[model samples]
Target: MPENTPYSLPKDSKAWQQAVDSIASLLPEDISLHDFDALQSLPVFALIVVLPAKVPALDIHHYVQSWVDEQPSWHLVTVAEDAEASFVDVDVATNGSTGTQQPFTPAQVFRYLLVPVTDTLMHPGKKTAAAHIIDDQLTTRLRHDLAKNYANAQATDHPENAALVHDNLVDCHILSIGHMLRTHKLACFDMDSTLIEQEVIVELAKTAGVGAEVEAITEAAMRGEIDFDESFVKRVALLEGISTSVLDEICARLTLSTGAHTTITALKALGYHTVLVSGGFSYFANYIAKQLGIDEVHANHLDIEDGQVTGHIQLPIVNGAKKAAIAQHTAEHLNIEMSQVVCVGDGANDLPMMAIADLGVAYNAKPIVQARADAAVNVTGLEGVLYALGYPALVASKS
Candidate 1:
């Protein structure tokens, strides 16, 4: 690699001095460099570099293929220098695929700037060869090759990546770039019907022969037809006379949702703060949390004395608003942006908290909940979340 300057320009930096210096050394002498903005708002690393003089509009379409093959990260967003027109501002989005973004890794970043200097841009003398050798056909071919390489890498690196596998299987046209996984610092999950299969209230009510009644309310609560707080109180009241041992029984029989284990494990591995916030009973929540290795559990505490339900809750029922409060609290405590947190549930009450989270997911939720959530999954497993996070099917399956 040639000893070239890296794109070390920070967001706040006024000029990409190195990029400008390089551009000036190659392009026509009249083409002067100007200011540029690091479009940080985008999910991918994009920069909108501006120039005072009009850029070359030559139909050097032949260079497109070479540029694509040689510089996968560079895309000609536009070619103009008009001040009032946004088209004049070049939108340069980074190809964060395997090779491009790898240089920005922690290890690479610490090892001095790893600039991408190819033989094409090397200095032969005072004036360097212009990179204007690109054409439309070449550009098209390059894009196709880059996309193929990206897909192949995805398959090789993450065979179980569900979305990629699904797309490939269906032969869907995968967009070049879209949603980027935001840095989520916190994650919140709903207990019953989401994290775990069993609803503690309905199961406990089974012992009292009121299973049908409590279940109806549970279903209604999840469907968003009934008030979560009221429905919960009515259900708990039915289970008041049951023995506390049943809690353990329910815990023993509880089944974790598909992908729950992998999702939580992966999130934890990535240093994400997770919480189990549920409208379900704490008895089952606490036990299931332990089994799944969760960091926090927030649910309704059953009022049991002498190993029997008192037919009443202790205090502070975990309602919809309360759930949202807990999620916000965790985000604030972790000093993470709200957008860096994810809340997931499958019930109507979960809507409040889900709305507050940076990313809200409705896992096999009722129609009402699904419509309100940012993302909804109707599948049998929790792994669908991996898709929303842009984890190709292969990676999700592996973990």
Candidate 2:
């Protein structure tokens, strides 16, 4: 390679060694360096050395499978290219020269191999770690070079038609594998309009014989016409003294919007720390969470006395703002950045939580929410949420 080539190594034929040195200097000095030469043969096109929020060695990729299996977002980028895809094993040794080689998995992007999820790179400690000294300009330049290279590969050799390919890229490069590989965390979701399904509440209320009244309140609350707190109080009060068992009956009659189940299940398997933050009651939320093995559940707790509702709700109803608070609390407890969290909801009440999460998904949500969310999914199943998080393939059915 020419001396001026951007990806070139030093004149000493020690590009890998020098790269190791640079990487070592950024990590703990007590750590050793293993053989880095094997990494030279692969095309990494770009590299992003980031500081993890917490749990520096956290294996984020393990939780990333669902996104790939479900939405297959990254496939869009590769679809635009003719480059052969391959995986390369890279060993990241923190223990200086004495470090032993431990198997590290990295995806080779064209010529550039990436260590996308490195908890060690971002030392999560009270004091700033030594690795922070890498020149920002150098890192930025390296990433830009990578993005440029990938862009070229997709534009030129990609097999799909130009227009369709162009349309896909234009719609979102954020969902591409490059972005996912570059991203530290992913947020998955349930759709059926929980993040976007249009009228789950209204439809259900119809069966409950309170469609018109419930629909009016839903409309008002969603339009931000009435205080969410007050609207919830009024709405639930209308359901007062209704049979608590009616909820189970409601579940039997419930109809999930197009993508509800698939999206939730896939995200759960992928380790997104999924939560059923719903405006709906515990009746449905609990069932959905249990079936999907969701890590958290937040919904209206039906105030029941003697197998019947007390004609009242438990104080501090789970409304829009409360939903947001729960999500924030989870992020804090996990010691993760809010950006690592995801919130999905459909109604006006869901807006608060959606607004607060790192990636708010307006799943089949109200138009107002759709306008405000970080992303939106209109795909047939909740699985569309997997796509929003940058997965490009459908999850294999688990028996």
Candidate 3:
């Protein structure tokens, strides 16, 4: 190993050839090299080596360290051990401009940075410092720019305190940088209180002159204090004799929650299969889905006769468990993996489906839902989901 060698591999130099030859000689015959790569930044140089199972981790570390020490520059070497694989990281310290470090390719892992978009540009050096603290190999693209109030960066290396580091980002709602932010092919949402501002049943109750009684039942059911099916039946019974025209009127008056349009529009443009699985009535859900361009809508059907509500609901009410089933079925029908699905909702009835999805987002949801969801967005609109999905503001805009 030559002393004072630059951090980068000199493709055309004798020193590079010698270093390669030395590494090959040091490896045990039983341990075969799976991959080899070199990464270079201004003040840091890294050589990544991957090996298959059954290699002695400590021995490789000691030998690699000794080899690195023979080099001219001060090099820091580390090793990562896995059940069937191992990675060696070598960082070289040098004198250079300590400005923004250009993104570098990592060896065998990916590093993710979860930060609030508003605070990302405000603290330009925070990311660099974070990368160093985590001992990441290189910073990749800002996965999500300052779009919908969140941003993320992808890099190399695994950080043990990933959650803690993510929470440290100022005003960051979620830092699902690593495995949590997988490519989602399907997205399922709850209609009432999630995609829309007011509950459709409550709106119908007011027209039926049972608003107060039905509202209490609705609230209790949403709070998980009552059985969804029973409460739903009770609420619908109060609307008996009400004109069917109420459904059309209520649907016309429905108000979409903030960022609802933006979120669904962006998801559609990104090729995501959007689904609205509601415990509410299809009378309203179908209309909402059409308006939002949702690909699918599944909800309860209200029975009517003589142009009036019969106080009867069709079979197979869409409850919590059913919602989950719908999500699973949708994923399977589309041939998407379960890990590639995102479910969002705001009520207790939404819990089951939320639990089954790869990433469950609580959108201004109930306390219980927020507590259990994988990610929660209480302060922002539905658009915040775009950020959670790792879509940058630039990409969101194009979508």
- List lDDT for all candidates, in order: 0.53, 0.44, 0.57
TM-score of each: 0.57, 0.53, 0.58
lDDT of 1 by residue, 170-282 (tens): 11111111112245678899988887666777778887789999899888887878787788788888876787767666666666775576567656755677799988777
| Best by the TM-score measure | 3
Q: Residue 134 error for model 2, in Å?
A: 34
Model 3, range 1-399, lDDT digits (tens) per residue?
222222221111122223323343333344322222111111222222221111112243443445445543333323222123121111222112211121111111111222221211213244334334322211111111111112211122324422322211111222222222245689999999888888999998899888999999988998899999999889988989989766777876777776676567656655689999999988888888887779999999988899999998888989999999999999999998877889999999999998888678888788788666766664356755654553322111111
Ranking by lDDT: 3, 1, 2
Worst 10 residues of 1 by lDDT: 105-114
Candidate 1 vs candidate 2: which has greater TM-score?
Answer: 1
Q: What ranges in model 3 sit over 4 Å off?
A: 1-171, 174-176, 179-181, 394-399
Error of 2 at 336 (Å): 1.3
Selected candidate, larger TM-score, 2 vs 3: 3
**Candidate 2 accuracy as TM-score:** 0.53
RMSD (Cα, Å) for all candidates, in order, is 16.8, 16.6, 18.7
- lDDT winner between candidates 1 and 2: 1
